[model samples]
Target chain A: MKTKNGMILSRYYTIADFEKEEAFLREQQRKGFQLKKFVLPCFYVFEACDPEDMVYRLDFAEVKKENKDSYIQIFTDCGWEYLFDVNGWSYFRKLADEADEDNEIFSDMESKIDLLGRVTKRRLVPLAFIFLCCILPQLVLQFTGMSSEHSETATFSTFFFWFFAAMFLVYSALFIEMGVGLNRLKRKYSKG
Target chain B: MEEKLKRVYVPMTETGFYILFCLQEEMHGYNIVQRVKDMTDGEIVISPGTMYGTLSKMEKDGLISFIREEEKRKIYQSTPLGTEILQLEVKRIERLYRNSKGETAVGK
Candidate 1:
């Protein structure tokens, strides 16, 4: 971990990997760094601290700006410190102590599964819709030469198709990854 | 309608049971957590994620209804439907406890 100006910037794509993200943050805390804020598109800002074991958890919520304060107050009142919100997900941490139950921000399997379902609806569904409804049709049209073209628009059209194709590939990978992660969490919780 | 509701909610999850139990009186999300903690003597603690999710689902299912807001916090209480379901659950638990205690045989 490198620190300059009292903050360390680390990059991690944690969109669909909540458990991995929590483990990463916990490891950082164990190394004497605590996460301060999360910037969009994978930047985590950390502040130096004494090495301590901290448990980090993520929750997906659609809190409007007006309701944000009360929403956070609920968590804070329950002993979970509010760290930051990024992309509709809230990050929280608590000290890992002798009380085995304190480490979890979710107490029951049903609630854990519900949280994953919300995350799927909020983040993954939209990406999947775009990939299937928008990008796939355009790609098919381009490949089949069914899309009308003119000399003037040919270059721009070709560039646009390739750009969208690349984006579709990336979104497709993300959609599948997120779907799988949610399913795994659901299965794990449903078993118990 | 009541019979159907009971069928759906008879086997309440622990979290759902606690949330409905706490909302017997009007309270906000945070207050419900504290109340449950106090009632259970720290044996059960509902996390914010679980509390909020349960509250939302209960409200949507008509098991709970929102009262006037105290500032930005939404106050809620169990509806008649919620109370009926909770009572059924309590009776079910009571029977389980009584049977397990050998006061009555399992099939009797």
Candidate 2:
């Protein structure tokens, strides 16, 4: 969507759906909206640019602040334009002609696997911890309370029970989706 | 060599090996990437992400030490331990090379 200015602000990406996110940026660039930067929780801002087919790639690395310059320098030297990073997800793009045949930010299978590992450890692991420790317990407790004390605060308990249950389902779905996606990527990259 | 360091660096990936090897002389991540691409005749171009990640890992593992900053690029060189680890890895690669050529060990 475009604001009064000629800039486009999109909010249709998720941490788990990075493949789609990269594609989304490429599509936008094709539509003449070049990505300028991003805000957290899925807002990718772009400015007007000449329509060109470029390849966008995302790399998940927990780099230190002091090392960020050198981190970007490496990519800049290798012909990738580092747009920006949000939450350890660095956004980069290169001309389609410049990218290698594989068109990947990682050259080796080991580094590809390493990127997946970082995503899992940084994203999925913490979500799993929240699902197991916090969400699940609250969900069970709310359900029990709703069933047992259906007298005074039945409506209140029922609301919370459903709320926690919905949260449980959402978290479960996210976890499974990302787990499967990452595993599929790992398996795909591991083969040759 | 320490067991932990050996396990980490001995079976180093090509990215890791080249990064650590090139750090024998102080160079930043981009320089190493260019050097590796040129060395391999562009057969093995180390992507910038891999180069940065490997350099950070080696720096943290004490295999490479940061020397100074030049134009916002941090220069690095192999520590004594890093050079030692590189030597071990080179020897291992030499053995693999010889075996690929079907050469038997000459003397113990």
Candidate 3:
């Protein structure tokens, strides 16, 4: 399709042309009519970004079919754009690569995952030490009959609470680390 | 070299396949987007950010190469390797269609 500016627009071209046409349409200051183009197998739908905002795209749709009626109907049903059969593979690859790049950019995700793993490991050491230092010694004293006839009772709930608390602390840390790792990997491989 | 072609699969991602698919018609980025939208009934969408990124990656991977930049938009075409991948994907999809038919129950 040819535009008023003498540019022969087609199914495939550069983004600059798309942006330029958008700008020209906006500069004319016409209200309601939108300047849309076929970027590939899709529609580069431009809408007013804001009242005073530069004319920009709100979203685009994959034009899998040549028919505008089908395209418009799908767009009306779901805000997401439809991809044409022709551009399906290319668009998928592009989406996947973008996800991969974004994953690489998340530097902090790696460290956060590592930090959580380390703390979880450390929590185990202190819990073990508590068992050896307090519980084990007390049990030994009771077994050896070192306690006086007037014995003080230790509740099972207290022991259960401490044991479970330590376990939960470690589990929580490990869980956080696992979550971070999965998220990072998802980002790294997040191809659409 | 033909055997090596088997190593590359048309990526499952829509953009990669769409880009390669459009190149079959010998088009550039903008045209590819239009063709894809037109073909897909507007179900699929590609943004400039995605278009540029995919084009660069495909060129790097030797799946597609730059033809030329006319009026600031770069053109791309499929390589021999890319063509092989597309053919393979076509075959795979065909098999998938056949297998799916077998799994579906016949109407009463």
Candidate 4:
């Protein structure tokens, strides 16, 4: 047995990148570093093990605290080892050898699309709402004639406005990217 | 409601069919999976993601209802609508099976 001691930090913006995340973890496992735990947002701790192919899957479930066990038990009983949950996303991994033919957490295309739809509704809809309703309007107002009348107030407001505008652009780009990725997934499954 | 359900769920997916069948006796998620696997002789295995996703959708569609909670496990059983739909699916499957067999064994 290889000595188990390794830690890696990674950042994934949205649940739509779940496939990429799973691939990354699978690659790491191939190199004998199995993910032991995941810290919220962007930290993954791994342990060394015999090199083996593993399948990692992510499910975005905002399970109630009371229902957490039963939610996890189903996966555990089905030979999927529950790794961790972060930000309403649950990570599960199983040895490749043990998995059934499909090896997917979702068996049917309709259910897979539905799961992605849930993630989109839970995570993307709110972001899209904020961008369309709040940030975009504020940015438009700031760019137009909404500057403060007083020079001091105007200078401060202008600085803050530009700062927020930049942040909003970054956030908006992320939201759009996530939306496109999710739409692609939906289309892929819907087509299948 | 029955007509609408038949239209929506007539040709049920294999996973959905087995799940509703398993829920006839008020089983939890894990138990439902086990029962399906046993009943199908390992031919059908509903993963956790698929199971819960189907359960949530079925519940939202009024096809199933939560029976009670037992130590953090939520017991669910098919509602009347679910049972009706399951029966419809069974009959549909039976018709398909019978037709296919009849077509294959015309001479025999």
Per-prediction count of colliding residue pairs?
Answer: 0, 0, 78, 0
Off by over 4 Å in 2: A2-11, A98-103, B106-108
Superior candidate under TM-score, 2 versus 4: 2
The weakest ten consecutive residues by lDDT in model 4 chain B span B99-108
Model number with the top lDDT: 2
Residue A9, candidate 4: alpha-carbon lDDT: 54
Q: What is the DockQ of each candidate?
A: 0.69, 0.70, 0.03, 0.62
**What is the total number of backbone clashes in candidate 2?**
0
True contacts kept of each: 0.74, 0.81, 0.00, 0.81
Select the stronger candidate by lDDT from 1 and 2: 2
iRMS (Å) per candidate: 1.4, 1.5, 12.6, 1.7
Off by over 4 Å in 4: A1-4, A98-102, A145-149, B1-6, B68-73, B94-108
For candidate 2, lDDT tens digit of each residue in A1-192? 776544756566556678888888898889888888776666767888889988899999898788788788878877889887777788899877754543677888888888889989998889889889998898888777886655766777788899998998898778788888888888888994
1 or 3, which is superior by DockQ? 1
| Candidate 2 - chain A - TM | 0.88
Residue range B49-105, candidate 2, lDDT tens digits? 777778888888888989999998889999999999899999999999988988878
Over the stretch A35-116, how does candidate 4's per-residue lDDT look in tens digits? Answer: 8887676777788789999999999866778778888877877789887778788989888855455478887788888788
List runs of model 3 lying over 4 Å from the truth.
A1-192, B1-11, B103-108
- For candidate 1, the TM-score is 0.85
All candidates: TM-score: 0.85, 0.91, 0.38, 0.84
What docking class should model 3 receive? incorrect
Error of 1 at A28 (Å): 1.5
Poorest lDDT segment (10 consecutive residues) of candidate 2 chain B: B99-108
- Compose the digit string of candidate 1's lDDT tens values, residues B5-102: 77878899998998899889999998888888899998888888888778878888899998967766788999988998999999999989997887
Winner by TM-score between candidate 4 and candidate 3: 4
